[model samples]
Target: MRGVRVLFCYLILAGSVSAQNIESLLMAGDRSAYNEIMSALQRKDFIEAIIGLNSFIPGYSSYGDLYFIRGVARMQLNDVEGARKDFILAKASGYKEENINFFISKEYLVGRLLKDLKMEIKLDSLREYRPVIESRDTIQGALRPERTCFDVYFYNLTVKILPESKSIQGSNTIFFRTTADTRIIQIDLFPRYTITSLKRDGKDLIYTRNYGGIFIDFGEIIPAGKMEEITIEYSGIPIVAPKPPWNGGFVWEQEKKRYNVGVACEHLGASSWWPNKDHLSDKPDSMIINLQVPYGYQGISNGNLRSQTDVGSGYNNFEWFVSYPINNYNVTIYMGDFVNFSEEFTNNSGKYRIDYYVLPKNLKKAREYYTQTKDVIGIFEKAFGEYPFRTDGVGLVEAPFEGMEHQGAIAIGGEYGKSNNRRDYWTKDYDYLVIHELAHEWWGNAVAIGDMADAWINEGFGTYSEFLFAEEKFGYPEYIRVAASNFSSILNIWPIVGERNINSNTFLGGDIYNKGAAMLNNLRCIINNDSLFKRIIKDFYLKNIYRIVTTDDFIRHVRDYTNTDYTGFFNKFLYETDPPVLSCSYSIDRKNNLTFNYRWTRVGPDFSMPFCIAVNNKEYIRLNGTSFPQTFSYENVNSFFLPNEYRYEKELVPPNSFTYYWTTWPF
Candidate 1:
C-alpha cells in the first residue's frame, strides 16, 4: 500500500525516470558548464566562477550541481541571499548533502557574521572579503529580572512590507502575565524603525529607547500574576540580512522580476522585523500573524493560516496563528507568488497534513520532492516521540534563503528539481533540508535554547538528529558516513556551547552544527548503547518541550538519564574547541608480544572517555585515559593493524602501520 502511494505520487510530481533522465545532453544543457564553474572554483577564482555560472545557468538551469557551484561563488562574492537561493535549488536538485553544506558554511565563514562559527574558514586572512555587516548588542536583553519579569502568553503582530520603498510598518500586541512586580516593561526594536504609537488598555504610554530596547512605563506597578497586554506601532526601512541566519534581517529578493520577501532575524533578533522582548529565553505561548503585502502575492508565516482577504485597493492580508510557544526569531513572514500541494501523513503519532509552498513554476518539483516529508517525519516521530506541534501540522515553505528550522513551518529553499537526486552517499532516499529542518520541530523549536550563547544546545542536537535519521534508515555504516560528512566541517576554533549574556554573533565557522554533532556521536560511542542514547534524546525532548533551556540543563539530563558522570566529556567538547588527542605507542616484549601504551596530551584536567583498541584485528579492549598496557599475545597476533569496520568515533584513527598511524593525528 505504501509503495502504491509512493508510485502514484511519483508519477504526478516526479515524472517517470525516463522523462527526467540525467544523461549527458549537449546543446546548452550539460555538466560541462557546471564543471567549468567548479574548475574555476577549485582554483579559488570566485569571480570567474560566478561569471561563468551566472552565464551558464540560464541554459542549463535544471542541472542541480550548477547551483551548488554558483552558491559557493556567490558566498565568495558576498552575495548572501544569492548564495543561499542557489544552494536551496541545488539541494532540491539532489546535489550531495555535504557539498551543499560545505558551501553554506562558506557564506557564514567568509561573511564573518557569527563569531562562534567564524573560525572554520581559514581564509579570513584574505583582505578582499565580506566583512560582518550586522552587529548586535544583546547582553542587556539577555537576562535582567526587569525584562524577564513577565512571561509572554500570546503575541499578535501585523506588518505591512513595502518592498519598493524597502520599508515595513507593523504593530505587535504582547499578552503577558507578570512573574514579578515591575512598573516599567522592556521590549526591543531596532533603532532604524520609528515608534509611532505605544498603548495599553486604549491609553497611550511614553517610552525611551536605548541599544535596541524600548522601556515602556506601565504607569503602575502591575502586581505579580496579573495579566497585561501592550501594543506598539512602528514603521521604518529595516536593515537587510547582510547574510541571513548569521547576520539576519529582512531579505527582499526578486524571482523572475517579482517581489520575493522573507526575513531571517535569528542573530539580529526578532526586533529587526517586529517589536518584542527579543531574548531567546522568553517565547510567547502562541502567536497571531497578519502580514499585509501588495496584491497578487500571498504571505506565509509559522503555523496554520486562518484567512486570506483582500482589503480594497491593491493589497492583500494573510493572517496566520501559531498554536504553541515559539521563539521571537521563529516568528516570520514570507510574501511571494506561491502555489501549494498538501498530503496527509499518518504514523504512530497521528494523521496530519504536510504542505509544501513553492513558486508556481516549481510546483512540479515541489510536488515530487515533498513526498519524502512523510518518510522523514515517520523516522523522526519514531525516534523523538510524536511530532511536537500536531495542531500546527508540518509545513515547508520555499524560502528565498537556504533554510531555517522555523518551528512547525520549515523553510526549504533547495528546489530539488535539478539537484542530485541520488542517495549515493546518503543512507536514505530523503532530502537533507527536509529531514534537517523537521528534525528541529523536536530539537531547535520544540526544545529551544535559553540564550543565543547556548546555541549549540539547539544546533548540536539538530545536527545529531540528522545522524540518527541516517542510522535509523540504513544502520551504523550510514551513521559513520553521515558523521564523517558532518565532521568535515568542524574547524573547532571555539567552543560549541557558548557563554551566557552575550550576543550570538561569533564565527566559529561550523563548530556549533558539525562539531557539536561530532561530540554527540562520540558520546553515543562512549555509552556504547544505542537504545540508551535514543532514550536520552527522547526523554530530553519530553522534559524541555516548548521551554527555553541551556547546555548545562541538557548535560545534567544526560548525566541523570545515563547514571554516569559525563561532566568532563561535555566540558571538554562543549566548552572547548579542541578534542583530546590520545597518543599510541607500542613495544615488542621479549616473548614477541606487543604491549600498547596510550596517553592523552593537551587534555582537560580530568577529561576521560572510553575508546576501543583492537589489537591484530582480534582482541578488542575498551580503554579510557588512565588505562594502558593493552597487550596482544604473540600467538594471537604477530603484527598490529587497525580495524576498519564501524566502531566508536575517534578522529585520530589510522591504519596500524607504525609510520602512517603515528604520522596522522598530531599532538
Candidate 2:
C-alpha cells in the first residue's frame, strides 16, 4: 500500500520509473560522469572538465552535482569568475538540501571572491563595483551519460592512528571499494606520522606514499558490492596535531585545562588525522571508534556509551560503536571532566532517552537551559518523521563555538552561555541555537543529503526549524520578527559552493541563516495552503528518511504532493541574482473603481515573485515579476497609499528601482 501511494505520487509529477530502470539510469549517469571527470582531473585537463561540467549543468541543474564539479574544475584551472558563475548557477538551481546551496554559495564567496589579493581586498573593503566577468574561454568537452541508480551498499575502511614523538605521530587508512579481493585499495594518511607498520584486512601489507597521503595497492580491487567492514591496527602519537579542519589530537589551553578535542574528518579535513577515502560517494554501514588516551582524561565519541577500561599504568581504552551509518567527519571525541544527565521518554515510535552531558562546572546551567528539550523533541517528532537514531539518544557535548548536530551526540558549548542575567542576555535566548542543532537530527543527521552540496537540507531547514519552534512557542508575530531579523542579516549576497570551511558556512556571515529561513517562508507562501504544505513536509520527512536527496528530489516531492508545476521556482530564487522589489499604490477613482498599481523594481538581476498586497481593508494578489506594473481595480475603496500600512516586510530589497505612483492617501 505504501509503495502504491509513493508510486501514485511519483506519477503525479515526475511520472513513475521502474525500479530497475531507475537503477540502470542512476548507475550509468554516476559512472559515466565520474569516469569523465576523474579522467580529466588525472590528465590535469581542467578546461575539458569545465566544459564537460558545463554540458552537464543544464540537465542536472536540480542536482547541484554538475555545478559543483564545474566549480572544482574552474578552481583547479584558477578561473575564479567561471567558478563563481557555475557555483551561483548551482546555488540558484536549488538542490533538495540547504547544505549544497550553502556550500556552493560559500565556494563562490570565498573561493572566487577571495581568489586573489586585490579582489579579496576590494570585497573585504566593500567596494562599490566588484568585478564579476568570466575571463576563461569556453572549452568543448565530451558529454557523459546520466545514471539513475540508487543502490544501497557499504565500503570498507581500515584506519591506524599512530603516535609520533610524545606529542604527535602519523596515521593512515586503506579504503576498499568492496570486501572481495581487498588487494587494490586506496590509502590516505598523514606523512608526519611515522608508519610503524601496515596491514590489509588484518594481514600485513606494503604501501606507497603519495603527494597528499599514502596509497595502498590492494593487489586487485574487490567487489563485495554490499555492506563491508575492514579493521586496521597501529600505534603512534598523532603527528603534528591538526588545527582548523580536522579536530583531533591535543590542545592544551592554560586556563581551560588540558582538553582532548576531536573534529575528525569534516569537510575535507579527514586526511589530517588518518589516511582514508574522504569522498562523499560511499558511506560506511557502521564504525568502531577506539581511542587509547593517556590514563587521565576520558574519551567521548558518537554513539551509545560502550565501555571504558582502565588499562592500568595511567592508560585507558575507550571503545564506541555507532551502529548507525555516519560520515567520516561526523565521528568526533571530547575528553574532559564531564557530568551527565539522562532521562527517558516514550513516543509513538518507541522508547528513547535524552542525555545532557557537560563539564561538571556547567551541569546546573546546562540543565536549566535544556529543561524544555523534551517538549522540543515532541514538537519536532510531530512535524519531521521519527528521530533517526535510538540507541545513543541525544547527547550535548561542549564546544568553543555554537552547536553542531553531531548525529546522536550534539556539540553545545559557549555558544549558548548567558551573559549578564539570563533575562537580559544578548539575543535574549541561547536555546534557539540548541533547538537549531537538535532539529538537525531529523533534517541533517537522519535524512542526510547525499553530499554537502545540499546543505540547505541540513542548515537552511535546520535554521528554519528555529523559526518554527519560535512560532510554536511565541506565536506568529514573534516568528515574523525573528524571520525579519534573520533576513536582515543577508545584506550582501555571493555564491557559496564547495567552500573550505563548513564551520564558517554553519555560522555564516550576513543573514544567511535568517534570510535562508525567509526564503523557505517565501516558498511556503507560494505553496500557500497550510494543510497541503504541512502534508508535503510530513511526506517529505517520511519518504526521505535515511536517504540523501538533492534539490531536484525535493522539488519533485513538493510538486507531486501539492499538484503544483513549480519548475520555474528554482530558476527565479536559487539560480538568479535578483530579489523582487514591490511598489504599492491604491486610490478610489471617480467611477468608484479603486485603482491599484504595484510596480516591481528588479533587485539583483530580476526575479518573478508572488506576493500579497493589502489595500483598504482587503488583500489583493500581485504577481510582481510576472508583469511590469500590474494594475488592479477595486470596485469600492476610500484611499490607499504605496503601502496601506507599515506592516509590509522589506525583505526583498530592490537594487536601483523606485516607486513614483501617486495615490490619494500619500498625496
Candidate 3:
C-alpha cells in the first residue's frame, strides 16, 4: 500500500529513463509528499496520516493495498469502525487478508512490517511491479468456491445524484435464484452508505451486517431453483474516489461551471457506489439502470440509452438498459456537460455506430482524435470478432481521471491522443488511450475472464491490440518495432496470474499489461507460423466470446487447437516470475561442419520453446529444446545473429549480453 501513494508521486517525477526501475526514485530528491504520510504513520498520528493520504490517493482508488495502510492508521487511532470499513475496502481492492499475511498481516500495524514492505513500496511505483509471491497463511480470503447456492441474475437500479453534498441515494432490486434450499443471502454495499430499508416481495426483511456484506434472512426456506427479488434502499456519501479506476469510489469534480462526475470501481468493486453481489463470477445477463440528476447535467450508463425525461424540480431521469451480460465492476455512471455525436460502421455481422461523449470544449480535440476509432474497430474485428456490444455501440466519455475500458462506454480523461504513452517505439500519431481502451471491447467486454487473477486475459490482449493496430495500419515491421519497445517496461518481479478470485492488478503488481502482451507477441514467434498464430488468436476470442475463462482454460485451448503440448509451456510462463531462457554455444567440427548446442534454462524442467537463429547472417533455422541440450548442424556457419527474444551469455564475445532483455544471464 505504501507503494501506491508514493508510486504515483514518483511517476510524475521520474521520466521515461527511470520508468523501468523503481529504486531509482530513492536517488532523486524532494520526496516529502511520500515521506509526509510515512512520518505521520511512524509517529502514530492517524489524523495527520489520513489527511496526507487523502491527497495521495485520487485517480488511483482501485489500489486497495494503500487503503490497508490507512486501515492500520485507523486501528492505531482506535477508530475500530473506520478500520473495519477500510479493511473491507482493502479486500475489495484485492488485498484480501490471505495475500498479505506472510509479509504484512491484516491484524499487524504498519510499524511491524515496515522492514519487508520498504522494498515492496519502492518497486510498485510503476504499475509493472506487484507481489504475486504467495504467503504461507493457510487462510485464503475468498478464492474458494461460493457456499451459497444462489446465483445473481439482474440488477434494476435507481440512483439519485447529489454531488453538491458529495452523497447519493439509491435503490437496487436484486433478482436472483436459489440453486439449493436456503434462507439467507449475501449482498455488499460499502458500510458508509447506510441501508435505509430492505424488502423482499414488498415485505420488510431482517438482515445483519458483516463488514461490507449485508446478509438477509428470508425467514422461510427458498427451495432450490426458486427465483425471488429483493429491493434495498440505501443512502450516504459513498467513499469519494481518492483516485479512480485504481483507488475508485464515486467521483465528484467540477468542470465547465458544473460538476463533472463518473464512477470507476474496477478493482475497488462496484459496491463502492451501489449495492450488488460484488463478485466477478455472477455477471447479470441484463440490467436496468435509472439515474436522476440535476437538470443542467445528464447521466450516462452502460448499453443502450433508453430514455431521458423531465422529473420535475430541475431534475431528469435517464433510463439505460443493457441486454447483454456485464461485469459488475464495469457498471458505471457519468454525469456532466456532455454532447454526443456518432458515426456508423457496416460490418458483416451488422451495422453499429461509434459514439463519442465529451465536454463541449473538448469536442474539437475529441473529433480530431477519435477518427482512429473506426479503423481500430476494423483491426480488432479482423483479429478477434465483431464489436462486443453493437446495439449499445462503442462509447467514450470525458472523465476526471485518465481513462478506463468501461464495457461499451469507455472513459477518456483529458488525454485524448496525448497520454497514450507508447514511448519512442510507436512511430504513429494515434492516441494510445483510444486504441487501448477500444481493444477491451474484444478482450474484456466480449470475451471475459471470471477471476481477476487472469486479468491478463483483458489488459494483456487489450495492450497487444495496439501493436496489431500498428501492424495493420503501418506494417509488420512497425508492429515489431513498437512491440519490441514494449519490453523496456517489463518488470519480471511477479507472475502474471495472481491468486484465484483476487484482482490480478491488486497485489500481483502491474506486469499484467506489458508482460502479458510481450508473452503473447513472443508466442507468435514460438508458433513459428504467422497464419497459425493469427488463427489461434481469432479462434480463442471467438470460442470464448461472452464467456468467463481462466489462464488454464486459454492455454489448454491453444494446446488442443494447435495439436501441441503446452501444459508445461504455459505453466512456467504464467505461474513463474521468470521468462524462459536459452543457453547456447557453438563449435566448428574438424570436417568444417558447424554444430550449435543450446538448452532451455531458468524454466520448468519440461519447458520446451522454439527458437530461430541466423548463421553467418545468412540462413535461418528453427530450434526447439526442453531442459536437455539439443544440437543443430550447418556447414561453414560463422557467427550467429539471434532474434530479440533470446537471452544467452556470450562465452566468446565482449559486452557478454545482447541489447535485448534487460536481465542478464544466470537469470
Q: What is the TM-score of each candidate against the true structure?
A: 0.75, 0.65, 0.75
Better of 1 and 2 by lDDT: 1
RMSD of candidates 1 onward, in order: 13.3, 18.8, 14.2
Q: What is the lDDT of residue 77 in candidate 3?
A: 36
Cα error, residue 52 of model 3, in Å, equals 49
In terms of TM-score, the best-performing candidate is 1
Lowest-lDDT window of 10 residues in candidate 1? Answer: 1-10
Question: Which residue runs does candidate 1 get wrong by more than 4 Å?
Answer: 1-136, 139-141, 417-428, 587-593, 604-606, 612-667
* Candidate 3 per-residue lDDT over residues 1-667, each given as its tens digit: 1012112211121122122222234323435665777676654444567667676755347766557666655544333345557667767777654433322222232222223323222223333334333321111124322225688889999998988798899999999888788877778787888899999878899988766667788888888898889999999987776655556677788855688888887766788789888777778888999989998887988888899999888889999998888988888899988899889988987798777888897789788877777888888888887887888888888887757888778888755655544222464456667788888878887788777788877888887888788888887656765565555455455677876643444323346777788778767766667788888889988888878877888888888778888667667667876676566666666766787777776666766666555555445555666679788888876555454422122222121111222111110
**lDDT digits (tens) for residues 405-524 of candidate 2:** 677777675524574233211244446656777887888677776554455556667777776776677665455555544543342343222122122232223233444455666676
- Residues forming the 10-long window of minimal summed lDDT in candidate 2: 1-10
Clashes per model (N, Cα, C within 3 A) = 28, 66, 19
